[model samples]
Target: MTTNEPRPAMTMRQIREGLGHIEPGQPDPIVQTTGYTVSCLPEDHDERWTYTVRVSYRGDGLWSVQCRSQYVDADGKRSPGFCWSRGPQEPATQAEMDDFDAEQAEWLKAYRFDHVTALRIAKQLAPTLTYRGRTVADALAEPVA
Candidate 1:
């Protein structure tokens, strides 16, 4: 910031809020890196990310919720929709390829929902999801493909 401030570049507050972590009394991870060039990619390889929730019912008639996420890279290349298992992939699981880091795919993992739970999430995220500075409903209302 100002010349009077310390040269470490990141305050404890900055580390917790900006980089999303706190390592008390340790060097800031971003400042400790070899190069202080970039922190996060602009749009994650120019990809448009999409999150989908699929609900299926078992024989018992309870809804079994699953999530599918697709990432389309800058070149308009898309990853398969599911790739969570270890080892060589079968044709069905081969649709996803964004597993380079576990944290990237972590958001899609925790969604076990019934009718009530699904409605709770929908109510919360309906206001949260935005496209081009508009709400999810507005985005859906647009005829843009």
Candidate 2:
């Protein structure tokens, strides 16, 4: 999820498409948008800015869209984080990006993937589940009545 590369601002449609591809029509899956600039960072200095779009679902479903950037500093040090300007000013350091990374990790750990999601992914990767000599669907669909 961390990239040292820089990219251009992305449109809303593009963001939606990217999310769709990742989760398809899943009822509960995290979606992220491509970063966009509310303003630009100076070419002479490294700065960062971040925006988090929180999405909540019923029964403790928490998700967020995080976007960031990195820019070159006057001292030739590369600032690693989102580089956006609010009110025509850039962040003085990369602290924001560091903080965001830590927070994101914590959130992910707390909101780990669900059972159905795990099963679905496993099924998609392989044709059959051989856990007990039966496919996953077969195993789950066994009569319990």
Candidate 3:
């Protein structure tokens, strides 16, 4: 005969690394942040910056998403720049959790929507944009119209 035991809460690093299951009191794993170049800029344009959406599990049962911008350097390094964040709000009920999930999805979708638009633009302007390139399109991992 074996007795069931409660597992320990995951550490932030463990959660971020996806090393374990999240228990009730443990924070949810953070989604990896992805950076996107502004669609309006030319592929080789100087002063181009990357925009990113970040979702984090703030401790104490709270979660938040941040919209951030970073300057890309000549060598492709990024500067720690600016952001706008919403919520460290705790969802205390199943309904609230569902709402939080929906809201988070919307925020992530909004960040990615620009890439889809850019792809459509690229497809339409293909010959003219023959030499231009995109990095964010791979992040979507699906073809878009």
Candidate 4:
């Protein structure tokens, strides 16, 4: 197939049918539909399919699903969605979270203000404003030289 050919659009039922075997975390009672619509390009032309995954969650909180796989096939075309096989679960560890936080903190350092510049800007913007119970000017007042 050429890389520019357009594939037929997939039906919603066909999309959900692929999700029958997926269960994320504990079996949640509510069912929600997550969809995927993708474009595929072949060596010359493209044939594509839109695959989707629907998940059920308990009817009272944030609805989410974690999966290992992320794609499905329809009409010989491929699309990405939730598609996970039950297997050895890789638990997200605290060290990973800590590393993420440390990276974020380092990234945020670029946005931290220089005391003198921040104080000057704050004074010009709102001389008497109290940002969080303390006056903005007082909070940013110059250090004794």
> Model 3 residue 72 lDDT?
25
For model 4, how does the per-residue alpha-carbon lDDT over 48-127 read when each residue is reduced to its tens digit?
A: 11111222221222122211132112112222332223233221454533544453443323222333333333233333
Clashes of each: 3, 5, 0, 13
Give TM per candidate: 0.26, 0.16, 0.20, 0.16
Native-vs-model 1 lDDT?
0.37
C-alpha lDDT of candidate 2 relative to the true structure: 0.34
lDDT of 2 by residue, 1-145 (tens): 8998989988665677687754445455567542222212222222212111112221223221212232322222323433232332323345732544554544344432343442333233333223335543554455533
Compared to the true structure, candidate 1 yields what TM-score? 0.26
Ranking by lDDT: 3, 1, 2, 4
What is the descending TM-score order? 1, 3, 4, 2
Worst lDDT run of 10 residues, candidate 1, spans 32-41
**What RMSD value applies to candidate 1?**
18.3
- How much does candidate 4 score in TM-score? 0.16
What are the lDDT figures for the candidates, one per model?
Answer: 0.37, 0.34, 0.38, 0.31
lDDT by residue (69-131, candidate 3, tens digit) is 322222233333322233443444556546545556444333222434433432332222111
Candidate 4, position 28, lDDT: 36
- Against the true structure, candidate 3 reaches a TM-score of 0.20
The total number of steric clashes, by the backbone 3 Å criterion, in model 4 comes to 13
TM-score of 2: 0.16
Q: List the residue pairs that clash in candidate 3.
A: none
